[model samples]
Structures are given as structure tokens and as C-alpha cells.
Target: MKIKDYAILISVIMIIVMMVIPLPPLLLDILIMINLSIALTIILVAMNTREALEFSIFPTLLLLTTLFRLGLNVSTTRSILTNQTGGEVIETFGSFVVGGSAIIGILVFLILVIIQFLVITKGSERVAEVAARFTLDSMPGKQMSIDADLGAGMISDMEAKKRREKVSQEADFYGAMDGASKFVKGDAIAGIIITIINIIGGLLIGILVHGMPFGEAAQLFTLLSIGDGLVSQIPALLISTAAGIVVTRAVSEGNLGTDITKQLFAYPKLLYIVAGTLSLIAVFTPINPMLVLPVAGLVAYGGFTMQRNLNKEEKLEKEASAKSPELDSIKSPESVIDLLHVDAIEFEFGYGLIPIADKNQGGDLLDRVIMIRRQCAIELGIVVPVIRIRDNIQLQPNEYVIKIKGNRVASGEIMLNHYLAMSPGIDDDSIEGIPTIEPAFGMPALWVNEDMKEEAEMSGYAIIDPPSVVSTHLTEVIKRHAHELIGRQEVRALIENIRETSPAVVEELIPNQLAIGDVQKVLMKLLKEKVSIRNLLAILETLADFSSQTKDPDLLTEYVRQALSRQITLQYAQPNQALQVITAGASLEKKFAESVHRTEQGTYLSIDPETSQLIFQSISEQASQMQRTGIQPILLASPGTRMYMRQFIERFSPELPVLSYNELEPEIEIQSVGIVNISSGAVNMS
Candidate 1:
């Protein structure tokens, strides 16, 4: 068995042995100190750890420590009554009161008991209970957030798994603490009871059994009893304080001591007020000047020192800024060359929304941009440029614009303080707010306050915050413009990245069969149709096989599509379900085949504009009909017409999925949803 497996059992058995055996005074003293050491170590660990989950073993350890301390108390009680001694440890602690008043030792013991039982234990127990309940209640939301990040491609599978495990561990830790808190509370009560028992039992044993005088018996046993209690209670007090800190601490970068000092010494203005109050007390109150004057002077001096440090820090910051290379370069903006280069993507927010755009003001737009870039890379297999975000004085307060290549592509307005509530199309409009349009999908929505969120949810409305609305719009915008972002540079980077894993594929395909530009065009063609180019090895291999036959990018793209049939079909068709599609009849297919025009540049559809309009109109009508019935709009045609039709219809319906019959796997069933038939009454094919 592993050491971890047996360690807990060994500790428990030792606790049992401690309660039963008659320990020697020397060994008893060692055990007592060890108990105090363990308790102190636990408290220190609690103070140092960054988060509660980092100390997940705390609850089980709490149980063991409490039992160990109790066992030591029992053995000491046994010694006190049995031989009128509890080792030198108890006698040493009792000496504190023996020099003067007996009442003083008893009062101090009682105070410690009251503080641990009534103050620390009670408060910590309540905190543990509340924390456990909240953690359990929020489990669903936390779990959902992890799954959403995974689904959005914002996080990889390994990251999502780790986050989910952390959520479960947090819930379990807090729940155990809720129950473990009872152990400390019981230990405190047991301490009080044990002290009383030791006192009464010690007196009886000393006077009746040992034949001592009543006064001497009382004095000797009372001191020993107080000392025994002190030893146990002090450790218990430390353990209880540690419990409080764990349940109450927020996740922070530093240890408890650093956090305390940093927060307390943050504001010198507050210190100035404190110093003034202390000076008033020193002058007006009956307090002695010796105690108050020097302390007040120290506080006044601390305030002055804090103010001086603050000024020095500000001065150093300005000096650092002045000395920065960027600042020096900005002295001649016209001469500097940075203004010539433009960002691939940029967001310009108006001045009123500055609070939400600044990272210091709780804005996580920068973080969201990173997630957006990751998601885009995962879904479309393209690297989106790092988006530049800045405040624009030219736009309205609530308005924002998204620019692609320094040209505006999309823009929207949002209310920073209110949430966007979109109807779920399941309930009547009972909740009232400012009606608006959702920018991502052009759906009708409402701007609702926080108070209305629950009601809106109850009414089946999708409530979204300003950041989310902007993120959704930005995601769609980037997805639509993904093709424009991928240039020869990005393609080269992809090839270099792939070379690390599959060098043979890159070596065989690039410069030998096709140049990097030729491969780039094929990748762009795939991206334009929303195909993920993440499978670059497969794409390169397919290009190598077919590039020898055709130097055309469009034909190479068709061959690549055939190679990616599984990826393409799985995305459009559900598993074990037939693929739904709109196909062209034989006559219409023949007409498109004959009209296909080829040049040294590329293939084109040479049909008259009038004939092309009629064919597209009929296809569009059929696609809309299928969409109304909730079927996805997919058109399958013969390989010859498929390429031409897609090239032909792309101008009108770029979002439509056009696939050749050969591009589908043989295993997938085909369900013909409609057939495109040009109206004979409207036009005739010559």
C-alpha cells in the first residue's frame, strides 16, 4: 500500500493509543509541544496558501488535529489526577499564576475559552456553512461556463477537464468544512469540561487519597488544572483561527500577512486622521502622556513617511515614462514610420463606453479578444490578427465600429449599464423594456435592467450583457471576413508549423508540385466556404496527388474537398441520418455543364445573364422553402455543374452550402429535399 493510503489510519490509531496508555512525563511533554507545533503549522499554511482548494486536505486534517489535541488533553487529565503531575509542561504553564493571584490564571483560561468557542468557532462554522451552500448552488453555473468555453473553442479539452475537476473539488471541500467546523466547536466545549473535571478530581485525589491539607490541595491542583487547560486551549484557539481564515479568505496573489500590510498601509490620508484622533486623546483624556505621546508621535511620523513615499513613487513614474523609448520616438510623430502600417482588425469605441473598454475598470475586452482569436483559429483553421481596440472621439457615446484592413465592416450600439434581453420565441412579451435589434442575427431584443433579469429569464428571454453582445457581433464579423485575413504570410506560417509534425508532406508539395502562392489560393478557397483548414497535412497530400494533373486552384480545391468528405459531411449531416439537399435535374445540369467556360485564367459560367437569373431565382425559392421547414439549405449537383453553380450563385447567396455528389461519403444516405427546375413558361434553354 502507498504511504498516503496508510498515513491517516496510522494517525488515528496513535490518537487511540494516546487516550489509553499511561504516558511518561517526558514523553507527555514532547506530545504536548508537538500538538502545539502541528496547530501552528496548520494556521501558517492556511495563511500562506493562495486559494482554499490549494489546501483541499484541510477538512480531513482538521478532524485528525482535533482528535489528537483531545487525546493529549485526556492523557494530561489522567496524569493530573493519578499522580498530581502532568509533566513539566503543565507545571511550567501553571507557574504563570502561582507567582501571584490564582484568580488571574483561571480568568485568562476562561477568556481564551470564550474567545475560541463564542467568537472564532461560531463565526467560522457559520462561514463554512454559508460557503458550502453557495458553492453547491453555483456548481451548475460554473460547470456550464466550462462546457460553454469548450464548445466555443475558447479552451482546449485538457483545460476544460481541469476546470471541471476544480469545480467539483471546490464543492466537496466546502461541504466537508461545513461538517468539520463542528469538530472544533466540540473541541472547545470539551476543553472547558475537561478542565473542570481535572480541577475537581485533582482536589479530591490530593486531599483524600494523598492526605494533603485542603488549602494546599486546592492551591497545587488548581494551578496544575489551569496549566493543563492552558496548554490544550491555546492550540485549539490557533486551530480555530486558522479555520476562520480559510473560509473567509478570497483568492489573492500574496499570503495573509502581505495582504494585511498592503491594505492597511494603502492610504496615508486615513493615517493622518488616525494620528489627529490620537493626539486629541493624548491632550483631552486622562491617559498618561508617557504611553500616548510617543505612540502618537510614531503614528504621525508614519503618516508623513507614507506621504513622502507616495510623492517619490509618482516622481519616479513620471521619470520612467519620460525615459521610455516609445515616448522619445513620439517626439516626432510625422518622422516615425509606425503610422503607415494598419491593423488587420480594430475596434473603436466611443468616449462614453470608455469605462467598459479600460482594463482597470473591470473591463475584460482584451481577454475576450484573445478568446475570440483562439475560437476563430479552432473553428475556421485560420489565425485572426490581434485586434487593436481604442476609444474614438469621432463616434457617438454608445456606438462602436469594427474595421477590417482599416475599412469599416460592421458597427453597433450598446447600453453599458443595461442587459440585452432577446425573446426566446416561446412566451408572450410580458416583460417591458426598450425594444431593440440584436446586431449579430438581426433578432428583436430589449434593453432591460438587472432587476428585470430574473423576470426576463422566466419569460423565456435570452439575457446578455454589453460585453457578450459585442463579443457575439465581433465573432460573426471575424468569421465572415476570415478569408480576407489569410494572406501568403499566414499560409507560410501554417506550412512552417505543419513542417514540425509532417515535414515530408510540406517538402513534397511546396515548390516541387506547386509554389506557396498556389497552395495559399487553395487554402483560401476552402476558408471562403467555411471549411476548417486545420487538417493541413491532408490538404497538402491531396494537392500533391492532383496538382500534377491540374495547375488550376479551383480544380485543386475540388479535389481537396473530395479528400475532406468526412469532415464536410459530418459538419452538415447528423450521424446515421440522410443528408438533406436540393439537386438540379438532368436537363438543368446539362445546360450548366454546356455553359461552363474555360480560359487560361479560370473557369466561368458563360450562360446569358437572363438565363442565370431564372435558374438562381428558382434555386433560391426552393432553398427558402426547405429552410421554412427547418431543413438546412444544401445543394448537391453533378461535379461539373457543382463548381460552376457555386461560382455562379456565390454572389447572391455566399452562405449557401454547395457540394458535388462525389464530395459525400458513400455511407451517408441522401434525402432529396427539392429539385431546381427553371420555369419553362418564363424561359427556354437554347
Candidate 2:
């Protein structure tokens, strides 16, 4: 373990020891929870970092406080009941009034929800990031090892501030504070509300069911006891949790996707509703109904306030609609059509320069091309490319070795032999008695010596050995096929070169960045053909070093190249290119546009029948595409574009379909895309 981890472990152990032994009962409850929390924090830090732990502290502290109070009540009441007259009665009374078991049960539930929140939100994000990063490593020049040592925790506000101070000289601290305030205040307030509601509900449940108004629940409900008491509360706990989820879904209405329980309780309405119901139950179940009556009133007050605020918002929206009708120019249907437009564009292949090291570089040319084509089709709107593989021979290291094990004959007789034994059938001019070769009846013939014929037949050996020239030719062909099938260094070098030059080139060469050898094909295409701005930027970086070495250019030219490289690098650096483009385009249009015009008169405030009809058609088309491919369409267009779009649809011979941006519905049933407010004027999109 690292020294830091060791220190934390030691400190937590010391704290746990103190908590178990000498601390007062009340303090012990607090210290025990704290100790447990510290242990948990350590595990989290080891697995993640400080940022993740910071989010857990609020819920932990609130739970500990509840447990501490529960313990105090139990100890004091048990001491009083010890002196009572009836032993069993006093014992029962003590259990109900003095024990703090209820709070402990509540604490467990809180911890579970906290864990769910972190895992759901952070866990999902971490998985996706790791996948993308892994996929990226296989691409050309961008390949680099990611250090796993980085903590999983988000950077702390204080740490973020410090980093920002170092990074931004002209940026204002207030801006940083504004952003931090949103999270801290929002999370803290939400935590407090949730804790209060949970503790109150549990307290009420304890009073009503266990007859413990100020003390612990009866013996049956003491912490960790395995009986009906624990089992029955499980359903109640789940119901509360479920209610919280439903309430949060209705109220929050956004991506609180991390912890369902935490988000559910984040809204004051859920907590208030749960507390009110539990408090009312306590009154009827024999506890002093008056004690819960006030609590119920408080919960009711909060609920009423929330309802009033929502009503006010609704009224304000109505008034605003009346005042400026033109504001609601975009409609739901037209927006969907705009989204489809984004999905239909396709990109063509653009290759970069290939690094060649040998004449056999052409062997893998098709495989390389196919890889790039598929990637471009996916990443740059190009279609899948066709790929083929071929084989070629390569020279081996042992080409010069030679050995001879036969006799040569001249004039139909053996001229020389390494070893020989005289035979009655073997003539002096025909040692081994073999005719070398002769054309007889238009066919070649081979003869063996009469004396060696028996030995050759016994061994079943070939009468004539094969020609070296034919054997050599077959060997060369086999070697060429094997080398070609495996791919050669030339192909590898070319791919590597392309990868180093342009990341886009690398992206284009592989399907999901899996083709490591297609980088060369990408480079070749980029250098040979015309391409888009994105591809051009990719090639600029790929060719920088080559250009610098081969051509003596002015400083201005080099500076331009450097600028272009930075731009492309920045583009690739964005987390999601498509989303980035949409947002960036929206911002630019918002700045440039003044007003949106409409077809009908009266300031054309909302989606009228004409716009609505057009938008309906657009949304219908988009809905169809969404069914085919599960991708949600994101519509981004200027107010002017929305208007022109509507007009274009009306006049076009093919009956062009377009969705309007102004008429988006609040719920998913009506609209899936939000209306990006770009200008002040009316542009009817529906």
C-alpha cells in the first residue's frame, strides 16, 4: 500500500478502537458511525478519490446525528425504568421510551440509497469513458498509455479553483464561484431536506408501531434483531423509497440519473409527503397525536409552498404567451425533420500519405483501403469499403546451402562416383549401369544400372531424382503466399506513418479504430484526392514534419501550419464531436440572428395551423427513422433557417418535410428536442 493509504488505515483503526471502548454511549454512537464512515471513505478513496467521498459526508453526518440522539434517549429512560415497581412493565416501558433503535434502521436505508446514486451516475460515466479511451489507443498517432493512477473522484471545488488560478490569468474568480455555488448549495439543501424527512418518518413509524415516542422502539424492534419487526419494516421502507422515486420523477424532471433514491428525496415534496403520512399514522396508533400534529403541519406547509410556486410559474407562462405570441414559433413536428437532416449526410474517403519501405507494399493495399473506407463511412459519413487480400513471396535466410548425393554420367556411362562396387552386370563404361536420358517414341526415358536396380526396388526410391529448378520454383511460390498472407513490414510501416500524420486518417482506416494496418491506406488517400475541411486538417498535421523537411518555407507558412494543427487537435479533443458541433453552431447563430419571420400575421407568436401542419409531417418522418435506428435526433438550426425550412417545404415539388423548433412540447410524447432560442423575433417552425 502507498504511505497515504497506510496512514489513513492507522488513523481509522485508532478511531474505531476509541469508539468501541471508552466513549460515552451517546458519543459512542456518533463515533461508531464516524468510524464506519471513515472506513468506507478509505475504501472509496482507494478505489476512487477525495471528490467522491465529499459527496457522501452530508448523508453520513445526518445519519450519525440521528443515531446519537436515539442512543441518548434509550440510556436515560432505561436508568429511570430500573427503579419501577413492576419489573416486566418497567422493562417494556424502558424498551419503548429509552431505546434509539429506530434511527439506526433509518441510517441503513440512507446508506443504500447513497451508494446507488454514486454507482448509477459515476459508474456509468466511468465505463463509457474507459471504452472510448481504449478504442482510441488502437488508432495511429494518438496511441498513448493512460495512467491508471488518476483518482476516480471529481476534482474538488477548492482544487479546481487552485488549478483555474494557475491556468487562467484573466478569468474572474466570481465566475468560478458562481458555478461552484450551484452544485454545493443545491446538493447541501437537497441533502438536508432529504435527511429531515427520512429521520422524521422513521421516528414516527417507531412511535406508532413500537410505542416509542421519545425513546427506542420496543425490544422487538431493537437494532439487528431477526424477527417480524425487522422483516415487516422492509416493505414500508421500500414503499417510502418507491414513493420518493415517483415524486422525484414528477418534480425534478431532468437527469438525476445517478441515485434514484437520493434524487427522489432531493425534492422537498417527496420528503414532506412521506413525513406527513407517517406522522398522521403515529397519531392514530396510540402515540400523543399532538406531537406528530405539529410535524405534519410543517410538512403540509412545505408541500403547499411548492404547489403555489408551480402554479405561479404556470400562470406566468400563460401571461407571457399572451404578451408575446411570436415567441413560440417552432413546433414539435418540424423540429424532428431538422433532426433527420442531421442523420442523412454521408462523407467520402480521403487518404493520407503511405510510408513505403519495399516493392511488396502493394500486397495489402486492398485490406488497407477497405479498413479506411469502413471507418470513413462510420466516422465521416462514408459507406463501408470493399477489402481484399493477396499473397506474395519473400526471400528466406538459407538460400545458398547445397548438397549432392548422386553420380553424373557422360555418353551413357558414369564418369565419376564417390563410391562404387564392381558388379558382373555393370560395365566399366556404365557404372551403376544407368542410361542418363533418351527420347524414345517422343517421350523421355530414364534407366538404372542392372546391379543397383534390386537395391532401388528394395528401398522403393525414385528411379530419377526431381529437378532442382522445379523444386526451387515451388518453394518460392509457397514462401511468397505465406509472406503476403501475414502482411510485410512495408504495409506495417505505411500504416504507422499514416497514424502519426493524421488522427482522422487513422480513424478513417479502421472500423471502430480496430484496424492498426490501415493507417497507410488512409494517408495515401488523403494525399491523392480532394477531401473535406476535417480531413484537410487531419492531413495538415500528418504532413507537417515531411513539409518542414522537404520544402524551405517562410516563417508565416510554418505558423499557419502550426495554427491548423492546433485547430484539428482541439476538434478531436472534444468529448463528443456531434454534440459539440450542435452547441457551437447554436451559439454562433444565436449571436448573429435578430428576428424570426412568420407566414401568418399578428406577430406570428406561436405555431399556427400552417406551421403545425408542416412540423407534424417532419416529426412523423423522424419518428420513423428513430424506429429503424435507436439514435435520438438532435435538431439544431437558426430561427431564419426554421422559417426558410417551412417555406422550402411548401414550395418544393417533392413535398420536402421539415420540423419546426418553436413548438416543442414539455413532455416526451409531444417533443423530444428542445427549442434552442437563437433570436428574439418570430419564425414559425410548426
Candidate 3:
């Protein structure tokens, strides 16, 4: 018998035995801790070791459990002492003293609970970080990939990066001094006010509930009754449960605040069951010998079920979905880039000094602009060129003082001609008599803005679309024509012309500095700008899998380039032949199975065909050794691998059935994969 079979069998028996045994109090406590820890670990494993597992609630729950036990002890002792002292004992304390003290204790506890809850809620993220750090500490030589999930896009990398940057900024000397001043002047006052409120509330509750005079008939508040007992506790019970649910939901959403309210509304039955069970235990368990187990079980089951439904699965899925966008950013298969084709390179920097010809301004820095244009080349499924631009300066209307910079090969007016010439089927004749030419091209002209016909005469530039149409409509018409009639080279030339003169950079930087949300927008724009060859291949693989399969390499390449040009999120990698080769091992196993099914005339164990060959191979050598010793042989196989072992042993005799691992003598054992710590020792039942 294989060792794995014995391990499984023994583990099952031990669990059954443990469940049935009446454990001592110390052992019961140990078991409780172990069981809860195991349950937590199982939930963490299912959630794939993500950040949510590090949330503060786990430790809070453990602390609550300890406090609940302490509360139980306090309740028991109070009950016993009060019973002994009797009604006369309170009378001896002059009524006022006992009432005031009871109120004080209750008020104190309430204040503590509220303060702790607030502190936890406020510092929950920090707590999660600490939890993650503690969890990793136990595993030596193992480091978690800190940004693995962010890199995968469950959370935005750009968002995390921005947060870190903000922290760094705040850590600077000036920022630190400003923060400390604010904290002392502002937060210190707020905290002091809260503390004062807590003390006043505690004192008021103490005086009203205890020290204040009351008749004998009104003395019922001191004892357990509907108003002062479980009924009063119900609100807190409901609130805490709702808080748990809300916190789980919000944490999953990467938000602050608990989603407890939602869970309370969702599972009315669970709250009822838990409340009823807890009430029953508090009221009756102390007096009953046999009710303990059932109550404990009910409470445990309620907690388990509540967490399972509301806290774990849905939360994990939300966290995982958050990562999809990062994955989407991979370059697609249709992007192509050819660096050898050289042309004008447009560099962008600063803004406003340059009036954008229209709203389609290329507002970005030179480095960023280059990267995005590169990405565009990869997306378009065509060869991209190394563009160089010069004499690129933005000017106000009617300004003829063009400060053309390095390598000023052409004037801004000349650049405008190259741009207009990129339309599919137009030429110099098409724009010959436009009115507002020179000023439209940011040049000195008296007739500019009077009409295209007037400007064309003044500056030699013309409006391809009629003046009655909106500028956007005209640009779209021009773009459509350029896309269809002009080839990539002409389009590249046109883009270069625009890059040399168009104010694209100013368009990008303004919005990002305005709000927190714009950070994501800016980041996405950056990612889409730069298309790399490696990224394009990754996108193609996904597309090929989900959409249509492609065989034409040229078409594939061109499509990738176009996609990159469009700035869509995608990733691609070249086809992997080696991976295909590795997958062939499955086919080899199939061949082996065929060979066994057709076997003939072999004396083997009377086993199923599936396991016959496995058993034959395993025991053949042992059988041969036994024959030389003039003795029979017995072979054991582990439970899960039994089929394989049975087939291996079949080469010997058909009469012998393979023994299972557990059925063998205690001293006999064999190592098995995916199992731990099996030994040739006596099996100990729970």
C-alpha cells in the first residue's frame, strides 16, 4: 500500500474522533484557536493571497472573541455576588452608590467601544499593511511581489504611484513642518473636544442610571429585563453585524467605511439565528449541562456562513476585477513599427504660447510625445518612421516673426502646405483661391478670417471644407479623406507637419493638475501613446484566442500597427513553439494507454484495466526477488495513486490483488508526492 492512502484514512479517522471526544477546557481553548486560524487561512488561500486578507477585521475578530469570554466571566461573577448580597445589600449601599457605580461602568464600556471602533476605521489601511508584513515574516527567504496585483491591474499602478509621490511630497521638510503645525492647531483641538464629550456622556449616564433616586417598583433596571437586558443589547448586536458586512464590502471596493448595513439588510435570518442563540446561551446555558455544544456550534456556524456569503467570495471577485484594466493595456498583435523610414520628428513642450490650429492639440512633452507616437506606429500595423521636426514654434494670430529653432528646414507656412497636401486626392488647385490663407496659418494677412477665399489670396492657405460648416466637421472630413486616399507615407508626412507646428502639448498637461481623478486619465493617455513590438504580439494572442484566427503575417502585422496607432489597450507576444512541444507529453501518455489496452497473454492481478498495468510494473521486481528466496511477496500502494500502482503490479500474477497503504503493517511505508511527513510508525487515532 502507498503511504498517501494511509495518511488520508488516518486523517479522516482523527477528525471524527476529535469531534466526538469531550475535550478538557485547556485543550478546548487550544482547539478553538487552531480551528479559527485554519478557517482564516483557508479563506485567505481561496482569495489568492490578495491584499484584502490583510484587513484589520481579522485581528479585531480575534480580540472580540477574547473579550466575549472575559465578559462571560464578569457576568457570572456579578450574578453570584449580587445573589449573595441580596436586595438588602443594595439598600445598605444607600441606593445612590450602587446605581451611580453601575451607570459609570456601563458608560465607560460604551465610550471605549466607540473610540476603538473609530480608531480602527481610521487606520484600517495601515493595519492591513501591518497584517501583510506579519504574515510574510513567517516564511523565510520568501518575499511577496508587492505590486503583483497592482501590476496585474486589480488596482491601478498609476494610482498607487501617485499616492507614493504624494507621500514623498508630504515628507519633504516644508510640507512636514506645515503638516505638524496644522495637526497641533487643528486636530489637537478636535480630539480634545471628543474626549470631553466622552467624559461628560459617561458621567451623565452614571448619574442617571445609578445615583438618581427611584422607587422600589422602578428597581427592575438593575436586573435583567426586556428593556435593560437582551432587548437593549439587540441594537448593538445589529449595528456590529451591519458594520462587519459594510466594512467587508467597502474594503473589497477599495473604499473606506464598512458595508455592514448592506449585509444586515441582506441576511435578516442570520442575525436572528445568532441573536437567538447568543440570548439562549446567556440565559439558559449556565443552568443546563447539555446545551453548551449545540449553542457553540450554532454560533460558530452562523459566523462561518455570514463571513462566507458576505465577506469572502464577492469581495475577492471585486478585488480581482479591479486588475482587468492593467491587463488591457498590453499592446495588440496588429501594431507594426519600421524604424528605418525617417521623417520629421515633432517635439512638444509648454503651451498657450502656441495657439492650437484647432481643438486637436498635441499637448505633451517631447519625451512623452515620442513614446506615444511610437505606440501609434505599432498599433497601425505598418512601418513607423523616425521623425525629426524643426522650426516648430507657436505664434499668435497675424504674427509673422517665426522663431524657427534647430534644423529649420522649412518655415511654418511651408509646414502648413505639407499638412494640407496629405488629403487623399487634393492638390494645389484645390486650395488656390481661399480667402483667409496667411492669418489662418498664423501669418500676417489683412483678409484673414474674412473667408477662406480672402485668406488664400493673402497667405496661400485655403479651407478645404466650406466656411458654413463647423471647424470640427471640416477636420473630420479632412481626416476621413486622408485615411482613405493617402498611403502611410503621406499620412506620416502630414503628421510630421502638424507635429512641427501644432500645439498638442498644451492640450495634455492642464487637466491633469486640476483634480485627483485626472491622474488616471493622464496615465491611460501615456500608456496608449507608446506602442512596442513585444506588447503588440501579446495583444494578438488574446485577439486570436477570443476573436478570429489569422494566418497572413503581413495582414497581422499591419493590423497590429493600426491598433497601436488607435491607442487601444492590448499586449502580444510571438507564438511559442517550445510551449507546443511541452504539451506533447500528454499525447505520449495516451500512446502508453493504447499499448496497455491491446496487451495479450500476461499473468497479472485481477484488477480493472485502468489499474492493471500500474500494479504489474510496481511489484514485478519484488516478485522476482521473492521467487529466488522461495517466498511469496506482498506490495502496497497509496490510496490516490492506487490505479497507477495496480497497473504497474500487473506484470506478475493475475491472482494477487494490490494491498492498500493502510492495510499494510505499521512499519511498511512508501513516499508519495503531494503528501507530507509519512513514516513507518504506528498510526495514532485522535
Candidate 3 global lDDT: 0.34
Global Cα RMSD, each model: 10.1, 32.8, 34.2
Give candidate 2's error at residue 560 in angstroms.
20
Q: TM-score: which candidate is best?
A: 1
Model 3, position 598: C-alpha lDDT score: 20
How does model 2 fare in lDDT? 0.34
Identify the candidate with maximal lDDT.
Answer: 1
lDDT of each: 0.87, 0.34, 0.34
Comparison by TM-score, 1 against 2, better one: 1
Residue 648, model 3: Cα distance from true site in angstroms? 65
Question: Per-residue lDDT for 1-686 in model 3, tens only?
Answer: 78997985674555455444443434433433443454444343323322333332433333333333223223322332233211222222323333444354345434534443344333333333443344345323221232333322234434656544433332242222222222222322332343333334334443565463443222333322111222212223332332233223322432222333444446635655665666677677565635555675666666667667777768888887997665555543323344343333222212232332322454222233334333444443322223332222454222222111222222222122222212122234434332233312223222223334443544444333221111222222222222222343443433333344443522232232222122222222222222233342333332343224443332233334344432321121112311000011222233334444322443222334544343234335445554455443444334333333345434445333433333333332232211111112211111
Instruction: Assess the local accuracy of residue 515 in candidate 2 as a C-alpha lDDT between 0 and 100.
Output: 39
| TM-score, every prediction | 0.61, 0.22, 0.23
* Deviation from truth (RMSD, Å), model 2: 32.8
Q: Which stretches of candidate 1 lie over 4 Å from their true place?
A: 1-9, 48-56, 96-104, 130-176, 203-220, 251-253, 269-287, 322-527, 530-686
- Candidate 2 lDDT over residue span 1-686, tens digit each: 99998986675455445433433435433433443444344333323222222232333332333333233233323322221111232233223433534455445434544543343323323433443344344433221111111111134324544544432321222223223223322332343343343335445556765457555533323322211122222222232232222212222333334344334534656757677686868866887878777777877787677667767888998998786645444465765676663211111111111111113643233333334443443333222212211211221211211111111111111112211222332233422443333211112233455556556445443343222221232222222222122232434533444466556744543444333333333333221111212343444443443443433222223223234444423322233333211111353244323233335332222334654454445544544454346343433344345433333333432122222233222221222333322223332222
Clashing residue pairs, backbone N/CA/C < 3 A, model 1: none
The TM-score, computed over Cα atoms with residue i paired to residue i, of candidate 2 is: 0.22
What TM-score does structure 3 among the candidates reach? 0.23
| Each candidate's clash count | 0, 36, 111
